[model samples]
Target: MWYLRRFLLRQPRSHALCPTSPSSSHAPSSSLPSSPLQCRTLSSTGGAGFYNFPPSAHYDLIVIGSGPAAQKCAIDSVKRGRRVAMIDKNSQMGGVCVHTGTIPSKTFREAVLHLTGYRHQGFYGKSTFTSSRRSSMNEILQRVQKVEDVEAEVTRHQMRRNGVHLVTGTARFLENGANDAHVKLAVLLTDPEQERKGIYKHREASLPKTLLTAEKVMIACGTRPVRQEETVFDGKRVFDSDQLLWGGIDRVPRSFIVVGAGVIGIEYASMINVLPGTNVTIIDPRPNLLGFADREVVDALMYSMRHYGARFVLGEKVGYPALASTSMEQGRRASCHMWGDFEAIPEHSMAAEQGGEVKSVLQQGGFLGRDTERLFPYGIYTIPEISMIGKTEEQLTAEKVPYEVGIANYKELAKGQMLGGMDGFLKLIFSTEDFRILGVHAIGEGATEIVHIGQVVMAAGGSVHYFVDAVFNFPTLAEAYNVAAHNGLKNMGINV
Candidate 1:
């Protein structure tokens, strides 16, 4: 991991992939040029190699993902005059970040909010139909498509203008050789029909299409949803994030019982709750929503969501819907309820208790208070989003690292207030002795976007005093740095 980090952060001194002069009309081909691209490759087995690939020939750098990080790295390499190749199995580029994960989800949230009258509920009551309401699923999807199209075009144009080759395929690394030896890659060209038949069919038709011998390769395949056999989604009733987007918007569940209160789940619940006549219930084992976020921001979000009639069933396990015994025609209403019975599984208890013996007396008749488990058959959402680049509170406690916590409410910032965002807050964890910022946590609107400020400070090995002494622009959300730094200093008994 350390080697990988070093390789990623290290700057190359020469251009290994491109040799064409910036003023030259044609790009330098795969031939030894005046300068070569600098690349460092690291293997899991402590094997490392530094190579300067000649400008002439095939790809010098091959990035195996089309997500934001992958795109950024590829574009940067291209700009440096390297022959870069980016590959993905999906029919479209941009990976999940654009196709399903971030852009599509956010766009859907915006559409839902607009359609549900949340944007102007104070003035329009429940009767008014916002632009999202009149828009069909196709319309909303088109917006996502348009954005992705623009992004894909931009990436393609940049790559082409910079002399990067974009390829579509499934790539797998073969056996490694001696030091400085070239690595083998198996690229499987995907067919639309074979992809429909699934991996088995595709595997049967797989051919050794191309052997890309590159000086460096980046594995940024991203991640996929984890599904258990017991809780497998069946398209109509249960759905994952990817399926939810392609399945259409007309099927929005009347009442959703989200099973997780993580960022993705809560974000979806918040967006769905904004829709008129739609009820959203979030379930999680954590006592507080957004447990990883700053306490103040979590509190504010909880407060805001409560006012919107969003229900939270914390510390609970969600289960499948229970079937009614009575026939539909037998003067009985169709029952649609899912129950999450709180079972004290011994294994889970032991695991939670760190392998310690659990002292529990099981009540007779399948335990008492079982009725507390009620049915709430509903669509569920769950996604795990977390960022940790520095010391956490637990680490500080275990290591006896003295630290002070400083918090700044985004609502207090001029830009935040201008955006009508009152829920987000920034917390800076700083060392009490040196006043260096240890960690920062922010959540609400643009939490991920703003956390980079903290990352920059931490990466630079700077201290909280840097922010406190620095002058931030007026009315900027970044002013939270000043607010938090000052608070940290006060906590440290410093005059500043």
Candidate 2:
């Protein structure tokens, strides 16, 4: 292990590199100090193949991260007989995925699944179980820690095994005055003394200024939880997705307004739903979750979520419009905000959902920043990847329409896991308060085709009982129809 010690001192002058704090510190740059300042360095004894080099070290390649991507890149270069070094400000070897994102989120899912017994919950009629065992935040997090520690250790072992040196400090690029092609910009590492003491500390009292120049630089720095300017993430009551799964959180909230319906949003909402005494309300402007997947898959997911006591506010904003009206002009038919210059034909009427900036009427739709609805200034998509057309449960609920959903999971299907895809579900929403099929929504490996099953049934004016009565091909996600029909019936107080 390379003990990256803290640089105890810096030359008393303005420096170029941005400051590196344990929190919220990005890279900064400044010219090297004219004179050296007192610093400290220390390393644990018995470090295999231990070596120390001043900050003036140069390498063939400098990777500015220690995540899976960085680790692989560094190791590959080393195998090709290239000298490579990796840098990371977070004292841990693994990046955000292992520490916060995928690893912890999946781990949290397992804990919730086991504690809630969600798969078989449908066998019981009610959303809540009086006999259900409740798990504490401490207990759940303790389980997550064991998994995280093992993953981190594996990552550290990989780096050491491959001889990829790790520099634990904030790294930023130095300005290249000459703009030389052979020698790229130098990288400056600003490590605080207190920071070094916490992690692997160096043995020397003074840490040499590290200014590394490399032939090439690769920025493998992964992502962090986005803390938008609109919301105040206090981390106690409010948290970004990353902070919620991290161990720093003290308690699981009794109630929460989880924003977004994307993968993270849906996964978290589902996980939280299984927790005892917890109510989860998911909000998103989209009409449904995993809208592009098969309607059946999404429907199945929604059924599971609702059965677990979760609520969704879909295609609706909580508060405020995107841009308010300054003055209502009689010349235009609708009250709208005009961003581009258009000849306003006097009294021309225009409805919303056309993506036009003008608000023709005082309709109940608008952006509420972070606390309200999502306001997208611009978002672009071009290929024909996947598409769907359906109404959400929120819409049905608001309209006082009677409907039931048949649900299925991709994992339940053998060959259709890809079609039922990972983290995907198939749902059939029908007017089946003993009425016709309403719509099918799905998101899964088999979403595209699975949805067609419900669509065909809906088109034929068949009720969900069709699924209950029919025998589907085995080892197929289509069989989810059987399970979902059973679940829908259970929810409606029907024994069959």
Cα-based lDDT for every prediction:
0.52, 0.51
What's model 2's overall lDDT?
0.51
lDDT of 2 by residue, 1-496 (tens): 0000011111110111233232112121344332222233445552322233343555666766555555656776676666777776655666655765457766777676655554344355235553655667777777788898898888788877887666655554544545534333333333444444533243222333356566666554544433334444555555556556555456666776665555555666667776777777776667866553444445656775686687888886534123121100011111111211021221111111221222211111334233212121110010001223355565677799988766666566665443323355556666755656666655544344565676567656688888899998887777888887887788778878
Predicted candidate 1 versus true structure: per-residue lDDT over 127-192, tens digit per residue? 666444443456556676677778767756665676656665566555544542543355554554
Off by over 4 Å in 2: 1-53, 119-133, 182-208, 319-496
Q: How close is every model to the real structure, measured as TM-score?
A: 0.61, 0.54
TM-score of 1: 0.61
Candidate 1 ranges beyond 4 A from true positions: 1-63, 69-85, 110-139, 171-188, 192-219, 285-292, 321-395, 410-417, 446-450, 459-470, 488-496
Q: How many clashes (backbone N, Cα, C below 3 Å) per candidate? A: 13, 57
In model 1, how large is the Cα lDDT of residue 434?
Answer: 75
- Cα distance off (Å), candidate 2, residue 357: 44
